[model samples]
Target: MPHVLIVDDEPRMLELLKLYIQPYGYTCQLVDSAQQALDLCRQHVFDLILLDVMMPDMDGWTCCRLIREHSNIPILMVTARNQREDIIRTREVGANDYISKPIQEGELIGRMEVLLQQQYDGLSYDRESYRCSYLQQKISLTKTEFELLGVFLDSPRRVWTRDQLTTMLWGAEASVDERTIDSHIRHLREKLRVCGFPIEQHLETVRGIGYRWTHQ
Candidate 1:
């Protein structure tokens, strides 16, 4: 069973998410605060996190941002805020996807299923040896980096948030910061640049949003 972390302040909400998701072959870890969630993330690994936007101490958006600073675990923001700006902000904070308040069981399941399947696909490949060459020099990538680039290569035009990279690459068993992923990307790009590779266009940065790989 895939381990899942459900971060919400409300006891009822946590219970609801657990009850709804348990039947789908997921193990749920319930927490009431963002701090506690982070504490849990430091040690135990979770496949996905269902985060609530509004919390007592630190809101889901802030928590997600902080979490992205370390791990790229996929976060699904569950919120009652239906405004466009709120949803946009959720994405800005590195949430892979967002679901509005009063979530339906079926809809939530579908989203979780899609995210989980994507993660599985990424892990299935031999991440260690997977490499890309630009120009004439060959730059080798670590398994995590390979998975990060895998998402980029799979969708060339898409910009992936730090959270997406963490979830797809690290999953629930390992630990690493999202910024560390940025470091690797920088190193990867630098290697490519020095190699006179023409594929640099594939690795694009979207300012505050995230990174994109757009090479054909």
Candidate 2:
């Protein structure tokens, strides 16, 4: 069973989420404040977190940022609005996914499963040999390509802007063109495709923004 941390300021909301999640075999611990949630997170081990955005002491964005500093555990933000800005902010803060308020049980559980599956299945990397494989098949990549993959996998589903990618790949002072990031992504896609993985389906292009690896 997966262990989940459910955080919301509303008592009823926390209970509702717990009810919806527990039936699916996930064990949950509920907290009514972001700070309490953060404190528990530091002291416990959880498979995933269902975090509400409108907490009193600390907003979900700040909580998510703080969590990302030390953990790569899946975080699914629960928010009242589904506005584009909210979605962008969700990614910027490093959440794996988000669900709008008045949450549908099916949608919530499906999203949770996808995030968890993405965390454990389909991909594996060997740090010592610098090798990457999807579904047990090895795919070759150049050093730059390997690092680019690292960035995407580090924060899967987080929208990574070209400026951010450029800075990450080659320091802020380096004169690397933003388009170089695109070229590397293209090459990465080709290699993944050659290995028979559905690279294009999950490694997405955000067009005006950049890229994010997502199960959706």
Candidate 3:
């Protein structure tokens, strides 16, 4: 069962979201303040977070930034302020998506499903064995290497710039040089090569751009 954290100042809003999501097999946890939401996140792992933008203390934007410092968990910002600038700022502050107030149930559920699927689909890791399933093969990988491969596999064929990979692997606040990305890719490729996967053919580099994972 997927667990979701819903953060809204209004009690009715929290109850409504719970009512809509619980029937769909999602476990919903509600909190009235961003601080409480943050505390819950620290104690438990949630598949997605529905964050309200406006609140009495510690607004959603600040809460999002603080969470992003240590996690890449998907966050969908909900707010009555639907200006273009507000939406852009939400993304800048590390929100995965945004939704305006009075959200449509269908759209909200669809977006949440997409985010959760992207985060969980096509990747299964066995921490005890240090193995990951990818391309129908179970291969061993270092923690860092597995994370990099998981990102590429999650959105196959999508171009990932070095900076984006750095941000996704290490948080935005971490200092990671672009060259370090190349080194990690090199190591990842070596591990894949040992497993008889054609890393060179599938993991292609776009000159002057970044890297992309493609199946031949």
lDDT of 3: 0.82
Q: Which RMSD does model 1 reach against the true structure?
A: 14.8
lDDT of candidates 1 onward, in order? 0.75, 0.85, 0.82
Cα deviation of 185, candidate 1, in Å:
24
**Model 2, 1-216: lDDT tens per residue?**
678999999999999999999998889999998889888988987878999999886999999999887766789999999999999999999888999989999999999987765553346565557878776677789999988887877676799999999999889998988888989999999998898777877798998999998643
Worst 10 residues of 1 by lDDT: 118-127
- Tens-digit lDDT track of model 1 for 89-187: 988998878898889999999988666544421122233446454322355666656666667756657788877777777776557787887897887
Candidate No. with top lDDT: 2
Clashes of each: 6, 0, 0
**True lDDT of residue 126, candidate 1:** 32
lDDT of 3 by residue, 8-122 (tens): 9999999998988888888998999999988888888777899999999799999999988776677889999789999889889988799897888888999887676544322
Q: Candidate 1: lDDT over CA atoms?
A: 0.75
Candidate 2: RMSD to truth: 15.9
